[model samples]
Target: MNAPRTPLLEMRGIDKAFGGVPALRQSRLCVGRGEVHALIGQNGAGKSTLIKILTGAYARDAGTIVFDGKGVDFKVPIAAQRAGLSTIYQELNLVPQRSVAENIFLGREPTRFGLIDWRHVEVESARILAGFGMSVDVSRPLRSCNTATQQMTAIARAVSMRAKLVIMDEPTSSLDETEVSTLFGVIRKLKADGVSVVFVSHRLDELYAVCDRITVMRDGQTVAEREMAGFPKLDLVAAMLGKELSVLQGTRRAGPDASMPEVLGVQHLRSGTRVKDASVTVRRGEIVGLGGLLGSGRTELARAVFGADAVDAGQIRIKGKLVKLDEPADAIARGVAFLSEDRKTEGIIADLSIRENLCLVLSPRLARLGIVDNRKQHEITEEFIRKLGIRCAGPDQPIRELSGGNQQKVLLARWLAAGIDLLLLDEPTRGIDVGAKAEILELIRGLADSQGLSVLIIASELEELVAASDRVAVLRDGHTVAELTGDDINESAVMAAMANGTANAAAPAQAGIQEVAHG
Candidate 1:
């Protein structure tokens, strides 16, 4: 037999830690030349950490990396890019204010007589985009185009760099089905051109459609590696969740009780372009989840309900009475609270102390004679800090100093302190550790069960929604297409609704639960 083929990229015995908290432990990955590989895991499973190390964003405490049969170390992101490696993050990193051609050729514009060659830059950028079947004006600002076009532009920049290895993180999160197909075609072309790609996404079908192999990570370790062909989807989910297949195949939570009072009623809700028509109801002591792809109006509906977005036409009922929600203050006064998806920007006041952030919503009610009651604020903060099990130095600690999970808990406490009757959570458990996710889910369930609070949760993770929700509403093209309940809430059923606008009745049971695909 001939000597074993050397991998184009090999990472072995990698170890990383943050403030004595280990993020990766002996994680190993090997990618063959020109192959499309997938890296998958839960929110805090060391996936981002590992990618950061590879791209030189973070220094690994210990590891060995071999690229193209040569031992190499990248000291910075630019150094990695110089070494023929490129990365496209989940969030588009291009400058929106810059022109498409300028963004593509940024920092490397051709110079003539020590001056930039604008004509060459525009021509080159247009040529590159055209190669990807994009025909937008190269001189226009990147933000002028739609999200799909911007995404393709980002990819075009990476491809223009002549990179041998490209890494994509949640690249399709903002793309529609047609745009996703276009992106896949580009990936196939990249593979054909002998460029290796490392794909990361939560969507399973996208992986099976494009990737040749997959590596699963759990709890900071590489759990399994297998070829994409014949690999079971349920097995992949179970591995990421760190649970057995049998456990996942067990019974789901029961549906909502009809006898409970309606806590919120939204009819014909329309907001902006994303939410054209949405109708939903949440009974007291029930968790209703909103499920759909990106731009499916899930977040828009939540914002409209919370009065953050202007409703063009709709009727909202709170406690069986018609209510006008013209602003967030209106919603809050009516015992409604909203936890925005972007916690860092929308949820928390990073510079403020935990006590301050928690008491922000309650400050109006807690004030006396225009002078805030500091003593009362402290008491409320201390109670929630203890009740939520938030790990922090003290109530006076800066919110920015805590971990993602702890910061999220602090945001939740902000709403809970107001004693709201209804909670609107958008991507509540996102960007946090798995342990923290379980704790937050449990806490939400406990509040609904004991305090009789109704929750409307919007999550991109179908399995998470199915597990935590009593009923799931699937939205497509700004419409509530289906509502899954009872035995119909499962990954397959949700995926079917999302993909075909209806669930397939004949899909086999991969994890014991049977699913139906209709509204």
Candidate 2:
């Protein structure tokens, strides 16, 4: 037999922890040279941890990393980059104020004898981007470009380094269909050039389309690793969840009480291509979870219902009364509150104090004849601070100083204190830890039960959604295709509904679902 070929990179028996708490236990990865490898897992499956260790962003507590036929321990990220390893992050790490050419060849530009060659930089950058089907003015500021262009620029920078392996984290999260296709083309080109790629994404279609092999992670461990050819998507999902679908049976619960009044309803809600057509209904004191894959328009539906985005054509009914929502103020006046998925950008004001942020919505009501009512504000802040169990030094502290979990609590308090009838929460428990996620979901559930707050939420975690939601509405290709109830609220059913883009034959969406037919 011939000698075995050495892999491009390998991390065996890796272990890591944060503050003595284990984050990775024997996590491992192996990527072959010139192969496109996919690393996939849920929100907290230690995928990021493993990648960080490989990149030298974090020190591995225990493990041997063999890269390019040498055992190495990278101390800093730059050190890893110099060793023919590069990373392209989801949010992008390039400076928007700089030119595209400057960003692509930021530090290592094509210089001409003790002087910067601006023309060469621009021409070379444009030439490289043309390979990816991107035609743009390279000298222009990066901010002028769209998100997809910015993302591609980041990838171009990685490729220009002549790296042996590239780690792409959620690279397609912001790209459109055409842009994603272009990205796949570039990846293929790299593979043909003998470069390896570690593709990390939650989208199954992209993984199955491009990746040669797969490694599934669950709870800080590598649960499965195999070739991608015949692996079924459903089986992959089950593996990622660490659930044996054949053995586990989901429990059925009673449906919502029909006597309860309808809180919110959307009929044929449409907002551009993001939300083609969506129809959903939420009753008082009920939590309805929105389920869909990436680009499924779940967030768009939530935004349109809350009046944050302009609805091109649709009808919204609150408490059986039709209302026109021209702006968020109109929705707020109608007792509707929205907690955006991006809390740092849309929800919270960095410089504002906790008390100020909490009382921002109720500020107008707390005012008297253009004169502020400071006393009532103070009392309301104190009461909510204690009642919501918000962990902070004091109510006057900056909201940014607290942990992610605490910041979420403050945002929740802001909405709850408004006495809103409907709460449109998009990914409320995101970017927080396991304990905090449980705490936030439990809090929402408690409020729904005790105060009769109707909630419509979108969660990436299927288990959490199944546990917390009274009903789950499945959206496919920007349309509300099915609604799961009682017995069908489990993960498998949700996945099937999302994939097949229809309701189970046994139970379909009540009505108005068949009106907006999908082509």
Per-residue lDDT of model 1, residues 1-519, tens digit only: 111144689888899999999999999787878889998886678999999999899999898998878888788999999888999998989999999999988888899999999999999998888888878898999889888888888888888898889999988766766778888888888899889999997666677788888888877888888887666665565566555533332134564578999999988887886777789999999999898765568899999888999998888899899988889999999999999999999989899999999999999888889999999999999999999999999999999999998998999899989889999999999889899998888888888888888999998766678888988888865778688887777766666565445655344423222121111
What is the lDDT, from 0 to 100, of the residue 414 in candidate 2? 93
Worst 10 residues of 1 by lDDT: 510-519
lDDT of 2 by residue, 1-519 (tens): 111145899888999999998899998899989989999987678999999999999999998999999999999999899999999998789999999999999999777998999998889899889988789899889999988788878878888888999999988766667777778888999899899999997666677778888998888998888888666666676677665545332442343587899999899988865787899999998999898865678888887877788898889998898988878888988899999989999999989999899999999999899876878887988998888888888888999998888899999999988999999998898888889998998888888888889999898778877888889998876788788887767877876666455544223222222211231
How many collisions between residues are there in candidate 2? Answer: 0
The true-structure Cα RMSD of candidate 2 reads: 6.2
lDDT of 2 at 111: 74
